[model samples]
Target chain A: MEWETVIGLETHAQLSTRSKIFSGASTAFGAAPNTQACAVDLALPGVLPVMNRGAVERALRFGLAVGATINARSVFARKNYFYPDLPKGYQISQYELPIVAGGSLRIVIGDREKIVHLTRAHLEEDAGKSLHEDFHGMSGIDLNRAGTPLLEIVSEPEMRSAEEAVAYAKALHALVRWIDICDGNMQEGSFRCDANVSVRPLGSDKLGTRCEIKNLNSFRFLERAIDFEVRRQIEVIEDGGHIVLETRLYDPDRDETRSMRSKEEAHDYRYFPDPDLPPLVVSEAWREAVRAALPELPAAMCERFINDYGVSEYDARLLISSRDFASYFEAAAQRLIELNPAQLGNEEEARRNYGLAIAKGMSGLLAAQLNRAELDIAHAPVSAAQFAVLHARMIQEVVTSKSAREILLALWESPQTDESAIDAIIEAKGLKQVGDADELGGIVDGVLAANARQVADYRSGKEKAFNSLVGQVMKATGGKANPKLVQEILKRKLEG
Target chain B: MIPYCADNFASIERMAISLVDVKRVAHLARLEIDPAEAEQACERLRGIFGLIEAMQAVPTDGVEPMAHAQEMALRLRADQVTEADGRELFQAIAPQVEDGLYLVPKVIE
Candidate 1:
């Protein structure tokens, strides 16, 4: 029997709060161990925890971003667990009532769009790091990360394949960073994901016994681990064995997931409302304020990119991968329209091709130039108006593609804020395209006469020989000849 | 637990803490309860549950759960980095410290 893999993700995004979730201690990473753990974070005697307003506001922003219902009143609960990293006997988290509940995210996997429903997102404190190495038969504890605020966003088991799981994880990862809630640094462990995977017979409503795979830091690991786990579950069941519900760990080196804790060692996190913290109440004005503060979300902007700009979904996804890229594309697009709009081509093609044109420039040569200079798109030396003019010049045959790249490199090296800087560079360098029929025809005629072997070869049906003639024409004209005009004149002269 | 029913009250009263239950709870809280201590603990737990039984008799339909006695909203603190490096001061109190990290028994997962 075939099995359908069901996967759900629980992402722990460490909020970028300056202080700990409950204590007025630095939440900065790479602090000396136990240095940033204050009295409250350490859970020392005679200390009470006060929730950070910034943390709550970040959570509210996430709820608004996902279109979730922001609970007016939510309570903190203590999840009792015994671990050396947890200085407190119990972890203070939201349970019974989380701050945000019931939201959905629309993820686009290839051409398929899926709406992954969210279970809930809760506020919780992070556990400290446990370094097992470098201590003989002993473990070392670093409490600097303890008590850091994290918003644990949980999703429903709607994903079917590893590809869809990755798509959902990436969408969530992009979203958290876009909203500026979490840094989304997987390397630094600011963002982490745990997937709950199971497999049941195809077309079955009942969910199979799931094993929670923990601490998949990278998306590649998430996909590989899920694939590994799904296959393992299928094999175990097919071999007349039963699936065990337990927590598992994904080992990237081994490329497999193994049970971290057995069923007998399962934790019964006796969850009860924390007595020290009263109910958290978010007012109507506060929710509206967060909603107003939210920037144009990625999904909505992506839709706008496809609908208004007439760009393909793949190009739209590439642009919307980051806010800086999307904004740069948008600004360049508007500048294109501001320039001679007719140069953008027909109305229908303009809507579809104009954004793609800007996207190509931004992602292609401009992206490479920025990388060479170690500059991001946000800090690019070339202004959007300048880029738009460059793209517009290409459309108008003012400069060939090769000359356009040369101008782009010049502008990149020397910072130019002026919008008309592209034209200045084009004029100063004399890189104008030879669009005149007479000028191009003379160049083509000279090339045809000079290269007798290529011309004779072309006449004798060596099809590639025609390209050599075109190259000679471009070389004769100092490489500023319009390629289309050059090819048109070359074909006309050679055929006649 | 089943709802407080007059017919099931007798069975509920008989459902006192078992030795196994006490042992499990003791292990979770990281406490040692000897067999004799378990017997005494069971008697004491019965008294606590008896009082809870008395309270459960009261009908509480449509009543919201109380998280705290006071109706005050939880106060929120500003996000600021006011704490400095106090590893020496804090690590001084720990029984074992190496390179500013607390040492414990190796916990291999």
Candidate 2:
């Protein structure tokens, strides 16, 4: 029997607030245990939580970015449960009322676009970390993370496959980083996901039992966990065994999920409106201020790249992966247009090709070099201005593709930032392409004279002999001659 | 819980806080109650529920329910890091700690 997977994600993104959500405690990571946990974070008697204005502002930024409804008034609720790491005994969160509601994200997986609907995003506090290793049969707790501000983004169960789920996760991750709300650092536990996965018969409307997979920090792990969980559920149902609803933990090393707790062991949570906090009210002016502060989102920037720059959708998407890359591309493109405004209008083909070349170089060559060194666009060794000059040189037929690759490597090693640096490199290394038609035609004539048999074979209408003549001309020029121009010269001298 | 029937006031008063219910509440709260004090606890609970029952009996069909008694907005604090490290001072009061971490019974990951 065919089965369809349904998945929802509950992600906790730690907001980049300077202080704890409801305390004056520092929210800096890697602090010593209990060092940053103040009286309020420690939940001492008589200490009340004061709402962090910065946390609310960051949440508003996210809501506006997603085009979600920012509630004018939302209430904090006390989610009561007992865990050793929870010093407050109850996590203060939004229950019935959330700050942002009913947003949707457009995600592109392969050639298909899917909309991942968001249920809500609410503000909450983080629990302390529990270190279960190296304690000699005892556990250690670090409360430095206690009360850190978090935005719990809950998504509807609209995703159908692991690939689509990963795409949604990536888009959400990029959006959070683009808006500067959260760092989206999975390794530091700044952003984490809990996937609720289940499988139903292909055409059935009835939902199947789901087990919540907890704390998938990385995208790869999120995909693997969902895949394993989906297969497990389908197999159990196919073998006439019903899946038990539970909370499960994904074991990455073992490549499977294990039940953390069965339904019988689940805690009630006992949610009730927090008595200490009043309704969190946002004025219309504040929402307007936040909306004004938001940067042009990735989706909008992507459309602009395609419409204005005339690049492929894939290229536009790649350019907008990070703000740094987008800004770099814009800077280089602006410089390119400024340098060749008159000539660009003369040849429509050249203008279109120049746009494509910029996108390709920015996304392909630049991306590969950055990935090889484990560096991001922010830390790129070559500045955008310097890269723009190099690209201009290539587009003007001053450097061949082979020499351009070599020049890029040399640029990485050098600290030269001026346009003259490129000229100096071309002069010093003698890597200039020979694009003069007269000079390349002479080289082609000499090659045809030396390879008489091959030239005769070409004159007899042998197509392969023409390529041989072009190769001979390139070899005779010591690979410095432009291959495209050489092939044009070879074709003209032979065929014409 | 089912709403109090208008005609079942006597039955409602009788079952407002039963001794068994009082014992169960105490157990769930992790508090041990002496057998002799069970009736006292039940009586006090019954009085509290009796007042609540009376309040519910009053017609509130059209009254708007409020989340809190006061209609005040929550105060917002600036998002600033103002606290300094005080690990030793905080850890001094802990029951057990080692290597700057609060020690507890072993927890499985």
For A1-85, candidate 1 gives per-residue lDDT tens digits of 9899999999999999999999889988886678898878778888999989999999999999999999999989999988899
Q: For each candidate, report what fraction of the true interface contacts it reproduces.
A: 0.80, 0.69
What value does the interface RMSD of model 1 take?
Answer: 3.5
List where candidate 1 sits over 4 angstroms from the true fold: A341-353, A367-376, A379-381, A413-421, A427-430, A436-441, A456-466, A487-496, B1-14
Q: What is the lDDT of candidate 1?
A: 0.88
| Proportion of true inter-chain contacts also present in candidate 2 | 0.69
Question: Would candidate 1 be rated incorrect, acceptable, medium or high by CAPRI criteria?
Answer: medium
Give a tens-digit lDDT track for model 2, residues B1-109: 1121333455666666678877765664447899879999988877876776877667866664455558999999888877777777777888999988899998563
State which candidate has the highest TM-score: 1
- DockQ (Cα-based) for each candidate: 0.55, 0.46
lDDT of model 1 at position A9: 95
Query: Which lDDT tens digits does candidate 2 get at residues A434-467?
Result: 8899998888888888999998897888889988
Best by DockQ: 1
DockQ value for model 1: 0.55
